[model samples]
Target: MTNSTWLKSADNRVKLLIFAFTILLLPFVALSFFTFPTTDDYCHTLTVNDMGYWAYQKHYWLTWSGRYIGTLISATQPLTYGSYFGYKVAPAILLLIYVHAFITFAKALSANKLPTWQTALLAFLMLFVFIAEMPSVAGYIYWYTGYYYTVADISTLYLLAYFFRHYPAITAQNIIVLSLGLILLIGMNEYTLVWLVILCGSLFFFKSIIDKKLHFKFLVLSLVALVFGVLSVTAPGNAARAESGLYPTPLKYNLLFSLKSSFTWEFHNLSKMAPALCVLTLVLIPIACILYTSRKPGEFGFFFVHPAFSLLVFAIALYLSYFPSYWSIAEPPNLRGQCVINFWTLIGWTFNVFVIIFWLLEKERIRPILSLGVLSWVVAFYFFSLYLSNFNYRSAWSDLLTGRAARYNKEMIARTELVLSTKEQQVTVPKLKNMPYTILNVTPDWDPAWASVEVNNGCAEWYFKKKFFYK
Candidate 1:
């Protein structure tokens, strides 16, 4: 076959692979909207619903607390969930924002303008987040309450990339966008503040120290973000530490638990590709390569400094955030989750690798061995995402549905009526309250203004007033 024909055939296979990968990812992303909602989902929904009610009653700026957002949603009836009329629409809005951001990023990168191999590489990278099944079943995404922050940050990252492309030197518009991101980061999740700090600080240091282009705009913007980020934390919901001491063990025990969770590739029957370990491996690879080759310092200065410094700084910061000496996972109390921390680490690590690869490819230094290693990593990612995508803890709907008694209770909650049961027909409460979908546990005698229930030995027979949403 002609050389061009051979190249074209190879390109076709790569495209086909990309297509298959995209198709596989489409379902999980779509299904997430309908997948049995999580406990946090309900909590967030309650907050959303409450926000709408509050906003309608009072015209006030919506704080990070779902109070304002929920109140806003409640003003509009159509947005209500099936039974949980108060369920917030923030999740859906966030999902839509992510989609728009991704599309805008693709267009801005001119990803389609690249060569076939480059295009395929970009496509894979673009879908990398989904392939990883981020913040879904993963602890960092699921447990840490990072799902919202991650979604927002992903949008911010797209904006950053867009700014990077259009204006190499920061401009007013870039500053505004980035400042907004920093504000949003601080408002949404505290951990994201660290990420914003790293990005902005890196840009400052990289410009001043490495590139010697102390662009005033960049420096001023970073400083502004840092200042406002600090100020933003003053909000009631956004505090220094989460409610950490409440669940106090010694720092040592907490650290051990966090590290154990972080280090082990497996947790809760789900296997995660350990981002920290992967990073350690990638870091070792270049160090070994450098020692063996002993290439001049300047020859690979960008490769050595940019990624190693950036990733190491972030990883170390994250590790210290869960430190043995002073850190506690329980404090701030607003949201407690550390699950997707590693996913962010993995993202940082992946970018670290990308920078290295880009530098190597530019220098024509991607040797056959290096190329093979890269290809192997891609395959590993594919299988890893494929496996993680299917990992879910719950099975069977019957196990989750409210019993007949609970259904009857819900009907009363909706209609403000009472449930009647004769001596011959016992109308007892179901196990619905234990399920994740339930927002509030309403009893047969419970009032909307003041709700309370008592469960002895984990068994409660009170009739519920209404059906919960997202069941």
Candidate 2:
């Protein structure tokens, strides 16, 4: 690569990264976060006895460890969707975490071989791939419980990056911190717990096979974390919880049912969601090929083989993501679970299409046919984004603009006045349900139970606990 060629590649990556940052940031533009707790947000909060560290000692190690941070910080609900758009630590932390994951995956793919910008491009492509096919992208971001799980789940990517980036310069402190991070990530949720183990184990085994010399320290950490992760899943508390009629089906029957459900769900979802999937692939496939398909620049004629290899890895990843969902009956079969699984499925589907297109571009013998196929999809995406997808975005944005949001925000303040003034156990706060959300049911209402001093209201006192609110 000449100086000019390298510079051009670098420039293209920066442009693409900026584009992705814009896309990832786009949803916040429609600020309509509801004040009232919606669906599971109410239920999850009810499980937390109080906001003390003892809340961390409760059963369900996996769910507690996964949600501990978010549940703690989220003492107050969004109050309004607009709360998340600002520079506050609460709203932007997830974006920063995602950026870190982006950087990590980029390093894995390109390392020193590609420019920094290319890494950014890869990260954006992955996010775009997931967002385009997501069952409910808004739910993953705006739903408090949903976002908590998603954040912990995404920690897998950060951990992978930590291993890849820090393995070379591992200090004692680094090892400890990284190990702790791994523990949190592995115990985040069963879905992440199961697949993350496979990811680390596969990496460990693959390194042993390919590198001929493996790091004993890395292996030890991996194995220890793996054991602890599995233990967390099967903790005595979880077993007791299960026995208490949380899951109706027996263990053996649940396993078989899970596998069957996993397959049936994937195929059914893929068929239903094909149009959006096709649009994302059409736009992203060629771009990934053009930017840098093979990690090694000198690998000639491996185009067809490499895409297949990429496809296989993503396919396995997608398949394994569903394992935790099937293993137990605790997992929801709605958009929340689908959103998590769809993240990986969409990634696999994108690579499967990208590599095939990339291979055709390499073969002049069948260039026109492949080129036409790519062109057709690209055109399809163009129409889909402009006509179909934009309607969805606009509709979502418009829904939030209703007086209900401003009304709810005011009602919440007024209700707080009644409670704070009277110091009452219960107050009939003014009605404040959110406007309809298209992708997520952010259309929330207060659970009447939450009004109790023992229940949600105490947990919610954190919202007012802040100095900013009191001052």
Best-matching candidate per lDDT:
2
Worst 10 residues of 1 by lDDT: 453-462
Candidate 2 lDDT by residue in tens digits, 31-103: 4343344444434444443433345445334343333344443334343232332212443456556767766
* Backbone clashes under 3 angstroms, per model: 32, 2
TM-score per model over all chains: 0.58, 0.67
What TM-score, to 2 decimals, does candidate 2 have? 0.67
Instruction: Give the alpha carbon lDDT tens digit for every residue of 1-471 in model 1.
Output: 584465357677576656655553443333233322222333334444655655433432323332222223333332235443222233344445544564454444432333444434433444454434443332222221234445545655576556645553446877777776666554444455556666677667775777666767777767866775565445433222233333444543465565664434224212344542453344334433332253343333334445556666666545543332233442221212242354355445545564565455446676413223445566557555644543331211221233432443354353322222323233333233332222222234442212221222111122222332212
